[model samples]
Target: MSCMKTAENVCSTGIRIKDKKLTWKRSWQKYKYLYFLILPGLVYLIIFRYIPMYGLAIAFQDFTVFGGVFGSPFAGLKNFKTLMSNTLFWQAFVNTIRISGLKLIFAFPAPIVFALLLNEIFHPKYRRVVQTISYLPHFVSWVVLAGLLDVFINSSNGVLIMLLKSLKFNPPNIMTSNTWFVPMLIVTDIYKNVGYSSIVYLAAISSIDLGLYESAVIDGASRFRQVWHITIPSMLPIICILLIFNLGNILDGGFSQIFVLYNSLVYRTADIIDTYVYRVGIVSSDYSIGAAAQFFKSLIGMFLIIGANYTVRLFDQKGLW
Candidate 1:
């Protein structure tokens, strides 16, 4: 009986080794090309993203450039308390929510609606031209666009400001004014991104079965009716999923646009977490405190993403798990 058990154990070990080898060989045979394709992306994520995550330790310490991440003394929650106590931080927090909320309200639907409008266009050549024109601004750098925006809204010399002045209007510097900061962010963001954003909707629209539209046409449905019932509903799932993802990013605001466009004049209304972090960390060299601020921002983002995903799942089972 002992001899038989030993022989069985040896046989099992041999099978396990064979299975491991076979599995490796099969995987290589089936997906070697795919693995090669993914290798660079994996390396990029590891090097650029994963490696930098080590810096998160700065959030816990009274860190300095000389002190380094581990060399610094722990400050407990003092940085957090300082963050909470600051009136400016609260104001910036409110602005982040308000600005991002407004953008979501207007900008989110703009692309979907624009895509629907464009999809209704029957002329292929004109549609292509419109697509190209609309897409052009998205590729334009925020720095260049900010400069152009400055040209259009310069209080003394911009085209629109000049026009307003001609009309006997005391035009505000829309680019630098507190009252216009959030509005400017939303409008410019929509302008730059709406077409590119609409591309997804366009793809979704184009993928809908042509048969559905034909059947609707046969049923005496007008074009508008078909779009309302057929097109909109067909795109709802993609919209919802994209919306779920977008909600996670709303607090980010437009860091680049806001940073480029804003001055001390609009800082009260325009300061976002990212810009604040940059100012605190790199500009001011308050490494430890900046890390704390950044950590706070990341925590909020994490909650936003999780909460948004949860809400989406509650409303619709098709959600990110």
Candidate 2:
């Protein structure tokens, strides 16, 4: 009887395994086209993102150009020690945190506010026009925008400077001013990204069930009340997710824009980890130090993401896990 019972358990387990295989086979047959569609993106990530991670090995090596990654002698913690001991690196670290924090405080909410206001617009055509105009700056490269800013705000004879002079007010060259450069970065970053970022919130808003608004209306709720009670709640999940993503990227201080817009005069205020790494690791031909800096930056970002995800989950929201 014991032998018969064991035989029955084995047969049941085999059937369950067969059933799972069949289900998976059917699922694959149904979604083969979707798999094919994602194949290119998967390939791109593997090639460009994952494959380059192998080069991080140089972070612990001397990493001479002639010796290359493999041939370079391992220096272990020497590169990290050099990085920690550098005062310029510490300055850049502080600047990166301050710049990113300022952006987070001001720029993070600009899109949410913009999207809320735009959603309140009853005129569809006007809304579309505004979106198009705002999105135009996002499509423009930072290089182009930086040049435009130079002409409009930084140049001695620039339009803004000329306008200020007409008002009998002396406007300092903000591009070179350590005090104003960070503020300039925040404002320009918002102008460049707010419209594009609003698109995500707008999408989240659209996905909200119309029935919720109807119920709110029946409850004698005004537009503001409906938005506050229903629309905002519906958007919470997406907002949390985006907040997590932004927090993860808190260390990245808009390198391309800063690199193009900043000069040696403003380096005290504008220099970030990325720019410092470029100057030290690339310009100075110290690949190991550069790699080490990048590795630490990426490590911090990863921890930020994990912590953010955990916090979001604590609020009962879905996380990347």
For each of the candidates, the C-alpha root-mean-square deviation to the true structure, in angstroms, is: 7.9, 7.2
Which segments of model 2 are wrong by more than 4 Å? Answer: 1-47
User: For candidate 2, lDDT tens digit of each residue in 122-226?
Assistant: 999999999889899999999999989988896578899899999999898898899999999999999999999999898898888999999889999999999
lDDT for every model? 0.83, 0.89
* Residue 218 alpha-carbon offset, candidate 2, angstroms: 2.9
Ten-residue stretch with the least lDDT total in model 1:
1-10
Candidate 1 versus the native: TM-score?
A: 0.86
lDDT of 1 by residue, 128-226 (tens): 999989999999999999889888988789999899889999987676678987788889999999999999899999999999999999999999999
lDDT over C-alpha atoms for residue 41 of model 2: 100
